[model samples]
Target: MANPPLTPEDQERYQARLQALIVEHRDLDQVISHLAENPPPDQLLVPRLKKRKLQLRDQIWEVEALLMPDEPA
Candidate 1:
C-alpha cells in the first residue's frame, strides 16, 4: 500500500528538525574528537555522548526518509 502524503507544514517541520539533529550530531563528533585528543578525558561521559550521537544519526535517517518521496519501482 502507498503511504499517505505529508502536508507542506509537516515537511517544513521535519526539515527543521532534521537540520537541528544534524547540527547536534556534528557538534557531538567534534566534542568526541577533542575529548579523545585531550589527556584524561572522561571515559564514562564519552561513551554516553557517543550513544546519543548514534541515536541522533538514526533520527536523522528517519526524518530524511520521511522528507523524501518514494521512488517508483
Candidate 2:
C-alpha cells in the first residue's frame, strides 16, 4: 500500500516516535546479546526480550510501511 505524505507536524511526531522505537529495539537487542555471554541466567529475560524484539520488529515494519510512499504492495 502506498503511504500518503505527512504534514510538517505529523512528520515531526512520527520521526520522534520512530527514534524512540529504534532506541528501544537497540536496547533489547543489546540485552539479548549480553545474556548470551553470561551463564546461570535468569531465564525469563530471554523470552521477554524475544517478545519485545518481535513487537518492535512489527512496529518497525509498520513505520517503514508508512514511510515508503511509493513501495509496491
Candidate 3:
C-alpha cells in the first residue's frame, strides 16, 4: 500500500530510521563477508550474521515500499 504523505516530523523520522537501517545493513553485510573471507571461521557467526542481514534487507524493502509504493506492479 502507498505510504501516507509524510509530515515534517514523519520525514525527519523516516530519514533517521533509513540512515540507521543502512548502517546496520552494511555492518551485517560486512560481517558476512569477513566470515566468508576467513577460513574455518566462527561457524555460527555466518548464519547469524546472514540472518541479521536478511532482516535488515526486509526492513529496507519495507521502507522503500513506503517511499515509492507506485513505482511498478
Flag regions of model 2 displaced more than 4 Å.
Answer: 39-41, 71-73
Name the candidate, 1 or 3, with the larger lDDT value: 1
**Candidate 1 regions with alpha-carbon error over 4 angstroms:** 39-41
TM-score of every prediction relative to native? 0.88, 0.79, 0.77
- lDDT of the structure predicted as candidate 2: 0.81
**Candidates sorted by TM-score, best first:** 1, 2, 3
- The per-residue C-alpha lDDT of model 2 at residue 40 equals 35
- In order, what lDDT does every prediction score? 0.89, 0.81, 0.77
lDDT of 1 by residue, 7-38 (tens): 99999999999999999999999988988888
Q: Which ten residues in a row have the lowest lDDT in candidate 3?
A: 64-73
Candidate 3 structure, TM-score to reference: 0.77
TM-score of 2: 0.79
lDDT head-to-head 1 vs 2, winner? 1
Residue 23, candidate 2: Cα error in Å is: 1.0
**Clashes within 3 Å, all models in order:** 0, 0, 0
lDDT string for model 3 (1-73, tens) is 5567767887778778888999999987776777688845457878877888889889988776666536454
Worst 10 residues of 1 by lDDT: 34-43
Per-model root-mean-square deviation over C-alphas: 2.1, 2.9, 3.2
Clashing pairs in 1: none
Off by over 4 Å in 3: 39-41, 69-73
